[model samples]
Target: MSFEASRDKFQAYLTKQGLRVTNQRLAIFDAAFAQKEHFTAEQLLDKARAIDDSVSRATVYRTLPLMTESQILREVDIGSGEKFYLPASGTNSQVAQVVCVDCDKIFEISAPFMEWYGSTVSLKLGLKPITQRLQVSAQCIAQRQTGLCPHRVAK
Candidate 1:
């Protein structure tokens, strides 16, 4: 969705929740939509601060959950133990994630089967799925051969 449409939708959601549309929240929303890739909360805070110094870390933390709850953002776990946020618009509504256990590299895969599966399950359970994410964790062959992966972070 376009920025204006997203803004309007979020505004309606905020209003419905009895939350005021503060400038800090708008700044955070803009920063998040401007991002072309998934981002951690810390990265979101930095981006928001770059846009407006008055956007506090507290605001980012608080607004992020609101955004997620409002369907403006989707929280993803890529096996990093850190929560990442991605826009809920367009292609991001349904996702399949592949995490390399040895390399710690995350790959977002597009699979129509996943979407169908989610829909089928929801129908069977008589539930509606707001968002769907499938995570597949595996060790890559190269990592198996080398006994270590270059991209693996020391945890």
Candidate 2:
């Protein structure tokens, strides 16, 4: 959807949630939707400032946590006091991700991976699983023997 459409929709959503639609929130949503992949608050502030050139770092920092709490944005905690934010699209309550430890590259994986994994372990122990949050990280060294990733190849 277009940025304006998304902004209007999200504004309505926020209103339904009894949240005020501040100018900073709208700017943040625009920046978040326009940006691809995960971004830190500093990165978001840079983009927000590029658009308005008057947006503040403190606004971005304060607003991000509100978005996370409202479920409009998702935060990936890297466990180093660094949290990356992204628009809540593919992410749900059952989302799973594979993050690179060295470079902090996150690849969103199939959510069913969590359920399948939980089922395997629960069946082994003869127990029923209630909820699951399984995240795994791997560092795959690229080799010349294999072909390039389709997403990486130039058009």
Best by TM-score: 1
Best by lDDT: 1
User: lDDT (CA) for every model shown?
Assistant: 0.83, 0.72
- Report the C-alpha lDDT of model 1 over 1-155, residue by residue, as the tens digit: 77888899899999999999998899899999998767889999999989889999888988998998887788887757888888876654456788787765666777778778988999999998776778899888867787767656543
Candidate 2's displacement at residue 109, Å, is 0.8
The global Cα lDDT (0 to 1) of model 1 is: 0.83
TM-score of each model, paired residue for residue: 0.77, 0.70
- CA-only RMSD, every prediction: 3.4, 5.2
Candidate 2 lDDT score at position 26: 73
Backbone clash numbers for all candidates listed: 0, 0
Whole-model alpha-carbon lDDT for candidate 2: 0.72
